[model samples]
Target: MITILMGSIAIGLSLGVLGSGGSILTVPVLAYGLGQTEKQAIASALLIVGLISSVSSFSGIRQRLVHWPLVWLFGLPGMVGTYLGAWFASFTTGIVQMTVFATVMLAAAWRMFKPSKAAPETRSEPSNWLTGFQGLLVGVLTGFVGVGGGFLIVPALVLLSGLAMRTAVATSLVIIVMNSFIGFLKYQQVLTESQTQLNWHIIMVMTAIGIAGSLTGQRLSGRLPQQKIKSAFSIFLILMAGFILYQSLPALFPAFTL
Candidate 1:
């Protein structure tokens, strides 16, 4: 319980400080701490992350940092894509899902190591279409692997939606909430089909602690050296990714594992 509580704080703090990585943290907490199967963990992660991001994004909305035009331009299609991906996951094995998830963790680590500093985006008919298409792709990855897609969405907003970095980050949060909740609904159906009783206790605890932790982290973000923090966290992500891959691979390729 202590470990789970600690992990919950870390999950929300990571997002509050970094504006991403909450989903990355949530799954392991549920899977390893709560002894949930991968699919269950993934399902739980979506809710936890969605709740935390809602709080964080609310701040941005209050500040008027969000770009509403971009939210609709990208998010509505993303909801559809997320649903498609979650549906696909129903046919997949946990090992297969975890393997893909570990791979995505490495990508997220790389993103943290080299965060985007893109020029302001250009809006046009063709570019708008491209942005929506990219949203679909990112949404699929999010729903399939249970990530927030913020790392991917932030960059896309900068390069494709003509948003300032702050606005892009804020807008990405809204989009994540939109896409993630739809994904969560689909995954719940998956859980129901598998006869799993979704654990609301841990979810509620994690969500509550996570929100408070995020508030603390936001306060601390101003005091801390951000790049150094993200650098260290990225290395931690790499190690965790490696561990996830190691755990899943032996079961996947038994003959080659040794």
Candidate 2:
């Protein structure tokens, strides 16, 4: 219980502080800390993260950091994609799932490490068509792996839309929440079939505590040197990715193990 609480706070703090990278930690914490099966952990984590990110994005909204145009532009189609991805995930094996998770994290890490800084975004209304297309692509990725699409959204906002990092992060949070909901619905089918019951009390308590911690971290985001922090985080994620890949490979290729 204590470990779960601690892990939740840690994840929330990371989300609040880093914005996009926090979702990557959800699976490991749920699986390792709460002693959940891979499927249950991933599904439950998606539910929790969706809620948590929604709240966090609200804070960004409070701070006037959210970009509404981008949110719709990216989140609309993403919702559909998320459903498709979740359905696909149901057919995947644990080894394959972990491998895919690790690969995605690694790619996120690489993106964070070498972020492209160029023009700042101007606050303006966006076209409906653009939001729909981006949302579809992001949603598919999110639904497929039970991951927040912030990893992809952040870059797209920064590069294509010319938004600031904070704005990109804020927008990513909103998009992630919507996409997560889509994934959560698909995941529920499996959970119901398996008769899984998450520790809701624990989940609730952890989420409450995490919200406080995340808010504090969010306040610090503007003050901190994000690049340095992102680089350090990227290194940590890379190490974790390497370890996960190493462990899962043996199972995927049993012949190589012998």
Q: 1-258 in candidate 1: lDDT tens per residue?
A: 897789989987887777778888888778877789999999988988898889888988999999998899889889888999999999999889899999999988898888556664444644777878888988898899899898788877776656777787778888888988999999999999889977999899999999988878877877887778878888998998888888899998887574
| Model 2: ten consecutive residues of lowest lDDT | 118-127
Give lDDT tens digits, candidate 2, residues 1-258: 678777777778778887776667778777666767777777777787888888899877988999987777677788888888888878887678878888998998898899657645455544667767777866776766677867678877877787877788888888888888879888899778768777677667767767776888898877988889889888988998887788788899887662
- The regions of model 1 sitting more than 4 angstroms off are 118-126
CA lDDT, every model vs. true structure: 0.85, 0.78
- Give every collision pair in model 1: none
